[model samples]
Target: MTEPTRVLIVGGGYVGMYAALRLQRELRRHEARITLVDADSYMTYQPFLPEAAAGNVEPRHVVVSLRRVLDRCRILNGWVVGVDPVARTVDLRPHGGPGRVLEYDILILAPGSVSRTLPIPGLAECGIGFKNLEEAIHLRNHVLGQLDLADSTTDDATRARALTFVFVGAGFAGVEALAELEDMAHDACAYYPTIEPGQMRWILVEATDRILPEVGPEMGRWTLEQLRGRGVDVRIRTRLLSAVGGRVVLDDGTEYDTDTLVWTAGVRPHPLVRATGLPLDAAGRLKATAELTVEGARDVFTAGDCAAVPDLTRPGETCAPNAQNAVRQARTLADNVVATLRGGELRPYRHAYAGSVAGLGLHQGVAQIYGHKLHGMPAWFMHRTYHLSRVPTLNKKVRILIDWTLALLFRREIVSLGQLSDPRKEFERAARADREGRAEEPVLR
Candidate 1:
């Protein structure tokens, strides 16, 4: 009996998860062995992150557990350190364990991107990214905690500082996060007699001239107007000079002190791609043909945000890094992988640009679809409808829909669980006191 070929997939994101799921159905159990490796065991639905932060959707429902969905495939929870295409081997660094190398007959590279950041002083220490589920949850808690601090404080300066929220970059992530959080905080302010919506300051700073460039210029202009009308400080063509000491200083000579800073400038390809010895484009993404096969690398397939797949529909431009493209590309990449394995002809991937949608806040959104522009409730509905269709799995889709249904009938929950960030702080402190042979009294503020 001959051993079945092994198919190894790195990164449990949309591309990796979808590709593996498709391959499992195409290849019989005895035909091949499939495996997926990722730092986390779940794939985050990034499009719904803003809603999660706003408490419209539960954070747990925003992630699809790879283990639960990819039952037949081996799920290895770890970081991929390196890959050698020539040797057909990958080096994986597991958490708190020695590294090990695994050999595979075919490899699928889909390690998604990380938050692209700039070298502004104090950013590394204070700035928070909005890419993952943890960050979304933390940002929700941090924002609500700030409201509590402001309400409890009598000092004008302290209250003002706590009420000021600054978001850098005006792309979908930055804009939607800022919008949803602002909306949630504003609604919660009704409960605090001392805090008012007018007291809070929401500032959006963009280096580019406009925000939401995914939408057309006309819709972008409309979005700018809508945001400014809501008392948001929309600053365009401005650069963040320094965030040192919580004092945000911009290149335009505007400086202010704020506790919250969200950096969502953009994203580059995963740095792991560079270490893989794979052919990379100028932007450091894996270079691949339209068929999703890595250029000059044998038996290697690539897709998603990590690969620079030429856009056949738009001539010179590569496919934009979004959930729509990632999910679609995965199916094509998966079919091509199976084709390669079975000695069948591979299919080239090509899809037309499907337009963009963004949720500004609850019941507020903007969308540009196939040259038609929509705003307000219609656009918001379109945003939800589109994402609900793409979020993966019938169970998750139903869960999210139920969440939306419940949200319509009840007020948004405003509770903040700030202690999640340091769940063991109290235990560690008590243990330290025991070691000192003293009974520590609970410290009262």
Candidate 2:
């Protein structure tokens, strides 16, 4: 009897998750031994993150458990420290154990990107990036906590600083997050009679001339107008100079004291790619063919944000690192992998640009689909409907639909569970010694 071919998949993002699921279903039992390793146990549905932060959808539902979805494949919770394609072995460091080596016949490298940050002063300490669930949840708690501080303080300076929120970057993540959170903050103000919505300042700073470059200029300008109409200060052609000690300084010479600063500028390919010794493009992403296989490496495949897959439709560009492309590529990648294992021909991945849809706030959105632009409530419905189909499993879809249904029936949830940020605070306080002194040693010298 022949030994089963071993396949190892790195990362648990959209590409990794969908690929594993498809491979497990497509490949016959014992045809291939599939193993997936990821630092995170669940795959985060990133498009819903802004809604999660705004309390429009429950945060827990935004993630799909890898173990639950990919039940047939062996799941390993760890980080791949290095990948040596020459040796056909990967080094993974488990949560608490020492590093271990795992050999594989084929490797799927989809270890997504990380937040691309610059060395702006105080950015490391102050700026928060919107990438994962933890950051989204933390931003939600921090934003709501700012409201609490403002309402409790009588100091004008302190109140002003607490209410002023600054978001740097005008991409989809930045725009959607700012709009959703701003809407939530405005709604939350009803609870605090002393805090008016007009008192809060929301500023968006983008170095580029226009926001939402993925969407065309017309839609981008429309989004800008919509945001400005909502009382948000949209400053384009401006770069962040420094954010030292909560003081935000823009290249345009505008400086202000703000407690909240969010950085959603962009992302770079995961650093693990460099250590793999694979052929990388100028942007540091894996150089992959239109078939989604790593160039010059027969047994290795690549996809998602980490791979620069040649855009067959455009003829000169690579697919954008977006969820749409990631999910779509997973299907073709999985099929191609199975075909390669069976000695069959591979198919080239080709998909046209489907345009973009963005949520401005609850019950508000902008979509430019197939060159037709849409806005207001109709676009909002379209935004929700489009993502609804793409958010993975039926269980997640049901839960998301229920959340939307309930929001329509009742008011959107505005309660800020800030204690989630410091869940052990009360316990730590209780464990501390009494003010008088430490308790006398129990009958000990």
Candidate 3:
């Protein structure tokens, strides 16, 4: 009897989950024992996160439960702390605890990226990021809560600060999030008697010369026009020098005191890659060939944001870190793994850049598909079409569609469950009361 081949995959993002799914489909029964380790139990559909924050989609729908999806693969809800490729072992820290080591025959490194934050003062304390489901829900509640605070406050400065929203980074994540949330906030104004559309400000600061660089220069210009037309203060070539003391100081010497600061500048590879002791590219990504195999490491594969896979289509450059590339790479990576296991020829990954789409609030957007430009309703429709087709799983697609359908027939829900984020606050208060020699007040329902 032969020992079962142990295959371990790190991370539960698009790359890891999709690769595992394909692996399960391709491999023969009992041929491989697959174990997937991730810090999160759910795979976040990152593109829908903006809509989740805007109440256009349910928060739960944005994340697919890995346990349900990857039932065939043994799932370990933990983070990969280190990898020993020479010894074929991995160290895992389950939710920031002490480590556990596991041995494997094949290792797939797809730990994915984290929020690429800068050392901007007060940002760590005051600023919020829009990368995951928790951040999305927190942002939604915080935005709605700001409206509530602004409506009740009599002071002009406090109301202004609360109403002022600043989003730094003009990439897809930052731009889309700002656009959707701004639209939602504007629609929410009707519910607040004291608030007006003009009173609320949506400021977008980009360090680059333009926004939506993925959409090309022409469409990027059009996007700027549309945003400015809708009263969005889009500032380009502006660096956020310091956000200390809740005061945002720009490189252009402009200053603003705002309560909300969303940092979506970009993302960097996960820190675990450093501990892996693998050869990395100049950008710190694991250097990978077109077939998605790590250089100088046999039986080790990497893809998605963590691997710098060569772009055969672009010659000198590597594939960009986007969902389109990630999905395609995952499929190719899985196939390559199967090929290596079964002694088949591996195929190189090469794909052309499909056109780009951007939604600027409701019923308005800009899309450039295969040299054709679209705007307004057509572009908004395209945005929905492209995303719905890409969002993975028929069940989630149906749920998202239902959410949108319901939105057309009903008003958007503005309720906030802020307490969910800090469930221990009530317990802390109760403990304080007990310390003060007062009987617990029946634990307020």
Using Cα atoms with residue i matched to residue i, what is each candidate's TM-score against the true structure?
Answer: 0.97, 0.97, 0.96
RMSD of 2: 3.8
Candidate 3 global TM-score:
0.96
Worst 10 residues of 2 by lDDT: 436-445
Instruction: Put down candidate 1 lDDT per residue, 308-396, tens digits, no spaces.
Output: 99999999989888888899999999999888878999999999988999999988999999999999999999999999988889999
Question: Worst ten-residue run, lDDT, model 1?
Answer: 436-445
lDDT of 3 by residue, 321-360 (tens): 8888998999999999888888899999998988888887
The superposed Cα distance between candidate 2 and the true structure at residue 97, in angstroms, equals 1.7
Model 1 / residue 13 / CA error / Å: 0.5
Model 3: residues >4 Å from true position, as ranges? 96-98, 437-445
C-alpha lDDT of all candidate models, in order: 0.92, 0.92, 0.89
If the candidates were sorted by their TM-score against the true structure, best first, what order would they fall in? Answer: 1, 2, 3
Off by over 4 Å in 2: 435-445
**lDDT of model 2 at residue 187?**
92
- Residue 344, candidate 3: Cα error in Å is 1.0
**Clashing residue pairs, candidate 2?**
none
